[model samples]
Target chain A: MTVLEMRDVVKDYRLRNGLRSTRLRAVDEVSFTLEPGRTVALVGQSGSGKSTIAKLLMQLERPSSGEILVDGEPMPYRGARAAAYRKAVQMVFQDPFGSLNPYHTIGHHLARPVRLHHPAFSRRQVAERVLDLLRRVRLDPDFADRKPHELSGGQRQRVAIARALAPEPAILVADEPVSMLDVSIRLGVLNLLATLQREENLGVLYITHDLATARHFSDEIMVLYQGSVVEHGPADEVILNPQHEYTQLLADAAPAPERRLARHRQPTLAAREGGGQQPLG
Target chain B: METTTQGTTQGSAQSSPQGSTEAAAPSATAERRPVTRKRRLFPPMTLKLGVGLSIAGLIVLFGLIGPLVVGDPSTVRDIGLTGPGHGFLLGTTQTGQDIFAQLAYATRGSLIIGVVVGAITLLLSSFFGLVGAFVGGWVDEAFSLLTNIMLVIPGLPLVIVISSYVPNKSIWLVAAVLAITSWAGSARVLRGFTLSVRSRDYVLAARIGGEKRWRILLVEILPNLIPLLASQVVFAVIFAILGEAGLSFLGLGASGSFTWGTMLYFAQNGLSLRLGAWWWFAPPGLLIALFGAALSLINFSIDEIINPKLRSQTRAERNRWGMSREQRQAAAEVTV
Candidate 1:
């Protein structure tokens, strides 16, 4: 069943002059459906409005046109309805550095959400729940007492995930979550997110520019270009047999081992022994 | 504390391309003696160099047990109240009031005005700014216009006109007027800053976490604005003190009060500056400068500490044994 649906979501931002103004279309008639317990990766280059779409889903930015519905009901833009939507739809931002509040401890960051979203949880229950969340993200429970500055980049990203999950959101919009992470730790975070998605039956909208990570993390891939989806399908099919020119260019740009080794070493020698084309392998 | 000191020491040592670890190590060791010891010597700001803090402390120490050592401030003397050879330390004023006693009693008023005015300004400006920034719409437009209008009006002249009209206004009432005048500029600046911070992703995360507007403003926005807001409060206090002095100097503050400003006002009318009665004017004038400078120094020091770029650039006077900029720059380049 489709849990979240965007029907022609269009967003425009106004640019000001001294006496005149211009409207720039950030998201142009973008439409997509997110199914239950599934992952949809919105793949786009910078300026492709993928992040705008994610914000629209989270209702951080309102759509200029069209409907955003959860369970076939159009979401309201303000007051109690907006509040309800906010509780249901959680977001993980791009810059892991700026995603968490710097002044607050990790436990303060997690507890507020759990207590607000799940009021039935007692003080001890909240404490236990926060610890469980920390553990689920592969962080030490003791680390909760520490501030965001005390944690490493990977650890901060995990805390962000834990905070997002505290609300037990139906739709989790992760905007380039692992892009800011080190390549070695990126897969682990991705795997954790995937695990949480299945266990919680979350409809995850994973937005990224990295086609390779998209293939690894997402079930269905939507290739957005210049504020519109040019190509989309099952992740493997879309990535392996890219139908559009932009998708082909993106697939060619994926940082494979052979190309990385070839930049300093030789591509011809490595290509002969099969270049790092298969990301799943 | 130990770990952070250890980390900083290690970082200084590991990254020391200029070979200044010999000097930086001891200072790092000195810094690690728990922030409490450092705080004991330098209690944030006012605890160390605040003339007001010291004067207030001294006055409190003396006031309760002061009468035992000295006579009442208001007590008049007819003769032999002229010279320093007598019992009076600061000698007597033209009205036969003891200079030292009057100074101590007057401090109570000044301190009260400073605290009352400073706190009022801080709370008012922060509220106005936070609301304007967070609510943002017609509310922002209305506040922006109001603050800008208030900013353009001559503050001192307005205070003079208003205080003159409202006869028998208390020191607290004068403070309220000053507070009302001073908050406009701070509100505008804080509003701009809060607007920027409110747009950050974490703020959105907090909103999505089901935080109310007040909680988001207090918990999310206010915490980040502390370093900025703290500096602002210090500025507000200095301004309030100076403004209070200015008003009193113009005879608009507490009437016939022995405040530093009132001292200046009375001295200007009474003592001929040409006659070298610098004794009357110089001390209080110097005290005003002292209060302003002390707050300014603490604010600048805090700015330096909180700001990493500034901290890196500034060398401590006590511990000047550090690598030069060229050396540090070379070291950072190597790291990159």
Candidate 2:
């Protein structure tokens, strides 16, 4: 089984100030292990360094001073080593519409990865592989010919997932993949990710803002706040019994039915007694 | 904590987060996009394009075989028979040359200069524009500076100075002068286009896919600009043709050249207007205007075809077919 680990990864970016520059640590000693068939949720709100972490793992941005290792070896930066590493790690970006190349057909999108990773595969084999990948994502075989713009949001996201999976990467870094999608189709995508994770035994770094869905989906939850992992544990433990103040705040902010029910029940009870209002839950 | 301000900006936002493909990449509307060709010069062409192309086609026909039809105008015919219904057809000038023959030969040179200059301009602009945008930073700054300097220079005076070295018979020299002066404006426009296209998500995705930079620049970036580039080529050709005519008419372009410009030059020099040789000056000038009109028509039609939003009809259609969120959901349900 493959294991992807980031050992004390700290990515610091330098902001320009005319001639002088100051360092800003984006991912401060953030560390996590993604084992095969397991999902690790990087839970954080906007500007919480969740995306910076995603970028670091995707190798789109480099960590300042840490080791991102595949198996036991540190990830290489250039040449065949980098290309091989890229083949093993593929990202499903946020904004499915933006992720896909609008000018190309869905087939061209899938073919690119397959061709890149499996150079020996014939044109016929690549075509077959693309069709198979589309089917796995529950997309119609006919969709392979359509452009990104022709497809709906859910359909485009599925295509993006299919494109990511084409290279047969060991680890899937899905960066808030469902956030930009419609609420109706979001569950379908989440379920698809879950199914794929189980079937392919792919290590998934599922990044998101909603702890509620992250609880249902991720095997492990790491609550990121202000560039540090404030809380990290097994999914149910984090959700059911949170220790950190920020985590508790997130839980409180989450729209739970019980809280709404209690608030509703309080108003009626007070009206029946014809008394002053009680405190809200 | 100071952590709030620490990583507030990674400067990655300046780079693309997702590396999106377009600024306002609206959905490719389903209904009428097929009106644009999947292949260049392909069928399923719009009525406007067809009409414009027909007009252009006739002018192109004139350029190609017009001289062959009437033979050489310089092969001096009967003199002093200056009328519409004479055996000389469009009648003879004071120099006894056939006006019809002059017009035919002039079309060949004028159209040739236009096409050659346009092609040269396209090559120069695309070279400076695409590479500069893709390779950015200092290279981009240099190209920007070059374009700005070229744009600021007085084009007509520059053309005049350059073409002065040009011999009377060398139409190519005149074409080259026009090409040098005209490319900067188009290059700037193309640079903006390249800058926009280079930052697109697909380009970034290609980079992540480990696609070679050259391949991304050539296959991916260049093809997207072809429609707009095609329109630019037509505009450049029109500019070059008119520039040549204006220069030659001013007696600064290729002397004795069988272009419409030289024909007008000769007509003016020979005092054809004062000498009652209406057929002498009138045909060449009329042809120039007609050719200009034809090219402009083609340019507008190409614009209409490639960018459908430019058309009022498409806008009206979009309004008619456009849906709100609930309506889109309803439509989705119906389709399902």
Candidate 3:
């Protein structure tokens, strides 16, 4: 069991233009805790530093200040402890197309993480584990031999999810896992993720710009605006009664069927001019 | 269900129709698998590649097998400066040496130089280029500086200067000189490519997956660069052969060895041009040019693998007279 905690994390990028150099704060001081078996959705528009937070948690980028603690211990930078840290936490990238290596087969992608985490496993065991992971993601085992290009966007994202699950991670940081997928398949992938999260009891950090899925899929919602968290509460409360103006704006941005139906009750200019508006119940 | 359709403005109607269409997508892809597998098993062999390979193959076979069957090139005979006739297949040199035998041995020697230099260049360039760019910072800066310095230096002058200092230059010595002078350009190319690949999301994912730096560089990055590396190596081989020929023509080539360059050197010394002994010089010169052109054509084909735009350009050129729709589709299928 592991509890991942970000205690006031900040990330700054040094931007240089010719001779002048400026510091851009990509992620301001933000804090959150991810307990096992719970999903925390980091909701924000693009450039709101949601990905920076994910990167910082993945240890791809070091925090400018503050510390990320894993189960009360500060994150290790290198050596055995760091490797163990990697085994506990895994990520699914946004772009399924860009996240996978084109030259490698899907089996290679899954087998690598399994092999890394379980060095004692024989070659046969590793191969078996790879096939098992594919099945767990509801994919045909034949997909193990196929390269990433052979798979559709939804299928590739499923493979990415399986890869994150291969190491049997305690926490999964999914960075816009389904955004690049087609709209029709998004729910299927998300439901797959929610099912996996429940089965594995893995703490999840679901990062996205979509507020509805954030509310539906996550237990808690943390609205990030300009690298800072403006609102953080239970998912329903955040959606139902947004405390921050930014959170209200985000909630308003998502189309509400009720709101549309109410608008339809009062005839709109286009509806009046077109004179062909369908009646709504 | 409401959450899923948020990306699209179509609202509730979007999901069902798209969902039905997506169900067919999997079966469609299942049918495509065997075709892709077949394509992979037998990649479409382009005309340029076939022509180049055949020409190169014939030349290589001649070089390898010719020396074994031919008589001694050094054997002196009474009949000197003869043309292609009377059992002398290519003719006689100024000293009655068998020009055919000399050409055989010379082709073999030049090929050996090209292969050796090519191997050396591949090692040196990949080290300085791929390694440096993958491991950036001061190391990259230092390597880039060294590569830039090497790139700026004139190859022929440097080779000439190095060759002049050595009293008895062997074939290996000439090959080494050419390799050292020629690798910088390929190194720069590899470095630029490595820089771009290093930052790709897959590489980052590998790093986050706890992959060691060396493994990431080797397994993740190296395979993608294979086509580029092959193109560079072919270019290197061409350069080595041509550079060795130039050095030998200038009377600074490997001594006591038979190469196309040495054959040309001896022919030039004997005034084969003035004496109209075309057999003495023409075969070796023509062989050098043919070999270079064949390798270049092969290089262009390899370049198409690295930059797919070149493949499309060639296809467009092939269909310049205007192909029918079915013909174009067939062409596309073949290429695909």
Candidate 4:
């Protein structure tokens, strides 16, 4: 019942020059579905239409020609219906710093969703709910009164996750949620998302370009290259034995620890063999 | 890589209270800030704020209670052009109207018109500017066109002509004239602000979060525009009061009321300046200047608070860690 499906969605942008128009396809005949309790990773590099897919699912932008279905029903078109649908499907944006309003306190951010979803809840109930959400995100309740500027990256991302979770959304579309974070903390945020997905039975569409995290975190991986899905299957099949050439290129690009060490050693070895200052590459 | 690293550190700093955020920020900022922290009377209050509060407090005090303590401004209770006598502390006008009472009552009219016009202009400008920028395309084109059309046209001449055409004008009518003419400038500025602010990721996030347009405008957009709005109101007040005085001096003021504009009008008509009777017009003129200064100071103070680029260099920063402050001072001395 909680399946979110994209059916052959096509999105095009019309570039205009003195009334002459040309179309550029951003997402070309793309199709996928996110099922409850499963994590679907949309993997691609920048401008490969990974985020455009996320935007399309969030209904921030419309598909030029395609169908998006929520449990076999067409996505809501009008404002009221869209708002109601939003309560069931929420988003955690890429940049946590930019996504959360700076002027508001953490309490304010957490309270808004609860208040919107449960209008019948008393003020005390809403307060407790905010604390509960903060707790769920592994944040201190005292952090609620602080502004967005007072929180760390991981903490802010956690708050953002908590906000997305506040409405008890069955589907969560997180677009590059950890790419901007420090390398050290990225795993912790990914693990939190994975844990939340399992606990809530949420359909998580985790959008990212980093295939390493995608392999470790996602149940299924969909490799997107230049707006088309080049590869899609179980995470292991996609990463360990990539079927498409583009997916192979991406896999090759992701440097493993041993590969990085070998690469670093080669440069020094090359330097020893009169390759010093030989353009470093 | 640097941007992402710095962003992570800043983000952690915000979340962590006084950790890596400060550790990173201080190194970048410490050299620039030589002035060390000291005990401040009002820690948050800026210099302009204190000065503005004092002046504004006086203006309000006069507007509220000054008239109540004086006799009626209209009553011709003394001989024409008489000095302070018979309890008339500010002497009498050419027509024997009490100058003190006139100044007090005039404060009310001038303030009333200025405040109302400020409110009206701010409303119109904010609505046009924010709505246009937020919902761009044809709506923005239309708004920009209207604003540009109004801006290029001479505002005062337009106000004068429009005011002249209206028969039996009141203070509110004068305010309306000022508002209609003056809102163009603020709308243009606000449109620029709104354009930049509307693109901030939080605003987009709020929109995608299912918050309605009005709520996004009010909650997300409006708080960011407070300083701009405050500055606009300050400008609007200055123009409204000045406009009032100009129109009234031109004999377009409400006939029944004694506004500052009318007071100046009467003073000019009676040749008070030529006759060496300074009491007639100087007080209202001085009050206008005082009000202008007060609002300007408040605007200046707020600018530093809201706009980081304009913040004062001599900030009170505590030299907590080492003799870096002393070392910087020595380095500055060496440079000098």
Candidate 5:
């Protein structure tokens, strides 16, 4: 069953220059469906509108024109409906370092979302639940006492995950969850996320610029470019046999192990550096 | 790995890291020796507590304790006019009150006016500023217009005019008037800060997290503003103190109250300074300088704490004083 659906969504942001000089179509005519207990990755380049789609899905930015249905119900933009919608749909941001408040301890950060959503939980119960969440995310429960700055990058990301899960959200919108992590710990975080998704049966809309991780982490993939989806299919199919020219370009650009090894085996580093590199017009 | 995890869990069960939820969290640093010292220390609570404590301590000592220990500050004495004696520790005024007593009691009034005016100004400025910046469009334009009007008008002159018109205005009343007029600059600053914060992802998160606008402003954005707002408040208080003293020195403040400015005004009027009665004028002048210095020192300390670059430099300086190369490297690595 489709847990979340967006139909023909479009977002246009007005530039600071008073004339509405530059109209940035962040998300244009983008449509996708997220099924229950499935992970869908949105892959793209820096300005490929992948993050914009996540923002649209999370209602961080309202689409200029579109329909968003959550669990076969039309999501309202304000008041009671909006509150309910927000509770059901939570986000884990890309930059773990930038995501959590540096001022608050991990316990404080986790407790807030939980308490806000489920006000009925007694203080003691909430405390227990927070520990469970910390443990689930692979963070030592004791780390909750430490502030965001006290934790390593990977630990902080785990806290972010725990915070997102505090509400027991059915759909988790993880925007580049492991992008800013250390290369060594990046796989661990991804594995932890996949573990949580499977255990909780969460519908995850994972946004990233890395296709390699996307292939491992997601069940399906959507390649976004210039405010639109260029290609969409099963994750392996899209990664292995990219259909669109843009998808192929994205695949080629991704720094896969094979590419790195091949580059190392080249006759001369400088000569091989420029080879097979396509210019964007 | 299992044993390490179990050990971490066991250690966590002992005390639990600071405020962690479960008992399974490590107590301090036993979890496979995870890099636990990575946190920054410039949180809002520390900032608030530090500033609040300094303000409280200063007020209690100078304003409350000093006055209680010394005799009535308003009365003047001529005996110990520059000659130190057993009774007059800081000497005596031309009219013969204890200079020490007067200086101490005067702190109460000066600090009161400063705090009241500064707090009022901060509230007004932050409120209008956030409203203007966050709620943009017509509201911003209207507030900008108001700010511009306040900006262009000569503040000191306006205060002189306003104060002169009123009959025997008390310090608090005068402070209220000053607070009313002085909020424009702060409002402009806070508005700019809020405008920037409004674009941040956390602010966006708060909005989507079902937090009301007021909560977002107060809880999220306002907390971040402490480091900046704190210094702003100190500066405002200093200005307020100066303004109150200036008015009193000019004989425009509360006629009944005996503040440093009042003493100065009286001493000048009585021709005490010219007559070599340095006790009266010097006490108040020195008091003003002392208060200014204390506030400046505290502000400097706060600035060091807030700005990581400064904090790191300070750490480096301390390291230079004592730390070994290996110790410094370990500290650096631990932080990462």
Candidate 6:
């Protein structure tokens, strides 16, 4: 079991606009802990430092300040410890099309991580593991031989998920994994991730803009606005009783069928009066 | 529990679209499989490629086999400065040396230099280009600076100065000089390509997968560069061959070797052109032009692989345009 912790992480970017350089704080004093078998949905709009936080967790970018700890131990920068950290914390990138190497087969993608983490596994064992991974992600075993272009977007995402799971990581950082995929297939992919998280007891950081899925899929919801967490609580409480104005705006933006039905059935007296007086105003 | 049921229903709903895609995939793969298999057996051979390969192949075959079948190129004959006839297929040079034998030997020698220079250029360019870009920072700065310096220096003048400085010049030395001068251009191209490729998400994904740096560079990045590399190598070979010819024609060619350039130099010295002994000078010049054209054609075909937009119109497309006015009118009437 692994507990991934981000202690007051702040990420800044040096932006240069020809001769005058300015600092842009992408993430500001954000802190969170991801315990095994739990999901934390990071809900935010575009340019809200959602990806920066994910990059920090994945060690793709270094934090400007503060520390990241794995099981109460500081994250290693390089060497065997770093490799171990990577194996423990894997990520599923947002763009499946871009994430997969077009030159390689799906089997090659999955088999690589398995072979990296488990060097003792034989070639046959690796092949078996790749097929097993394909099956786990609801892909046909035949997909192992196919290049990424041959597969649909959803299938490719499944392959990406399978590749992430190949090392049997304790923490999976899904950085808007389904945002690039079709809406019809989004729930299926999320459900698969949820199922896999449950099966392996993986700590998941599900970064997304869709508040409905955020509330439904995660145990806790963190509403981020302009690189800062505006509200954080139990998923339903954060959605139902938003404490911050940004969170309230976000909650109101999400289309709710029941709310729409209620509004259609009965327009409030004030709303009716306002509708009647709209042209004069 | 309700969400799980909803998810299952959606999952099943998801399969309908997936099933349509799955239905489409098999036929797509079916069309793709034979094409891939055919490609494995033989790369897509355009008319230009076919002609280029055949010409190059014939020249290479002549170089390989013609030397063994012919007599000594330098042997002095009684029939001095004769035209094509009298038991001499390409006649005699001004000094009575068999022109055919000299041409054969020159082709072989020139080809040797081309191949050697191509290999060296491939090594140097890929090393400076790929390694620097992939490893970046000061190393990249140093390499880019070196490449820039090399690029700015005029190639032929530098080569002439280097060749003039080195006495007892051999074919290998000349090849090395040509390779050193030509590699910088391709290195710059490779560096630009490598920079673009190294930052691609697949490469980043490989790094996040705990893959070693070298493995990611070799496995993730290198394979994508094969078409570009192949085209660069071909261009290098053509440059090397042409550069050597130019050097040899200036009488600064390898002292002992009988390259096409050296043959031209000897013919020029003997006043073969003034005497109207076209066999001596013309064969080598024609061969050089033909070989260069052939290699250029091959390079163009390779370029099409790198950028598909360069490919010419297909037969059907051309045929559509080729229809006469009557045929066009008939086709229009049929459509109506």
Q: lDDT per model, in order?
A: 0.79, 0.84, 0.92, 0.85, 0.79, 0.90
- Residues B197-284 of candidate 4 have per-residue lDDT tens digits of 8987788767666778889989989887887888899889988898888889999876668778899999999999999988888888
Which numbered prediction scores highest in TM-score against the true structure? 6
| Residue B131 lDDT (model 4) | 94
Q: So what's the TM-score on candidate 3?
A: 0.90
lDDT by residue (tens digit), candidate 1, A126-189: 9999999998898999888777876888999999999998987788999999888999999988
DockQ of each: 0.69, 0.34, 0.60, 0.47, 0.41, 0.70
The pairs that clash in candidate 4 are A150-B14, A150-B15, A151-B14, A151-B15, A152-B11, A152-B12, A152-B15
Position A88, candidate 2: lDDT: 80
Candidate 3 residue pairs in clash (backbone atoms < 3 Å): none
Error of 6 at A85 (Å): 0.8
User: Whose lDDT is greatest here?
Assistant: 3
Candidate 1, residue B226: Cα displacement in angstroms equals 2.0
lDDT per residue for candidate 6 within A3-103, as digits (tens), equals 99999999999999999999999999899999999999999999999999998988889999989988899888888888888998989999999999988
What's the true lDDT of residue A105 in model 2? 86
Clashing pairs in 6: none
Pairs of residues clashing in candidate 1: none
Q: Which lDDT tens digits does candidate 3 get at residues B1-336? A: 755564464464555565766689899978988887665333357887788889999999999999999998899999889889968998898889999999999999999999999999999999999999999999999999999999999999999999999989999999999999999999999999999999888998898889999999999999889889888998999999999999999999999999999999999999999999999999999999998998888888878767777776655787776989999999999999
- Docking verdict class for candidate 1: medium
**CAPRI level of candidate 5:** acceptable
Off by over 4 Å in 2: A12-25, A266-281, B1-47, B78-81, B167-169, B305-308, B313-336
Assess every candidate by TM-score.
Answer: 0.84, 0.84, 0.90, 0.85, 0.82, 0.91
In candidate 1, stretches whose alpha carbon ends up further than 4 angstroms from where it belongs are A78-82, A256-281, B1-71, B272-279, B312-336
TM-score-better candidate, 1 vs 3: 3
lDDT, model 6, position B296: 88
Ranking, TM-score, top scorer first = 6, 3, 4, 2, 1, 5
For model 2, fnat equals: 0.42
- Model 4: CA > 4 A from native: A79-81, A260-281, B1-43, B83-87, B313-336
Cand. 6 Cα-lDDT? 0.90
Q: Lowest summed lDDT over 10 consecutive residues: which window, candidate 5 chain A? A: A272-281
**lDDT (Cα, 0-100) at B212 in candidate 6:** 89
Candidate 6 C-alpha RMSD relative to the actual structure: 6.4
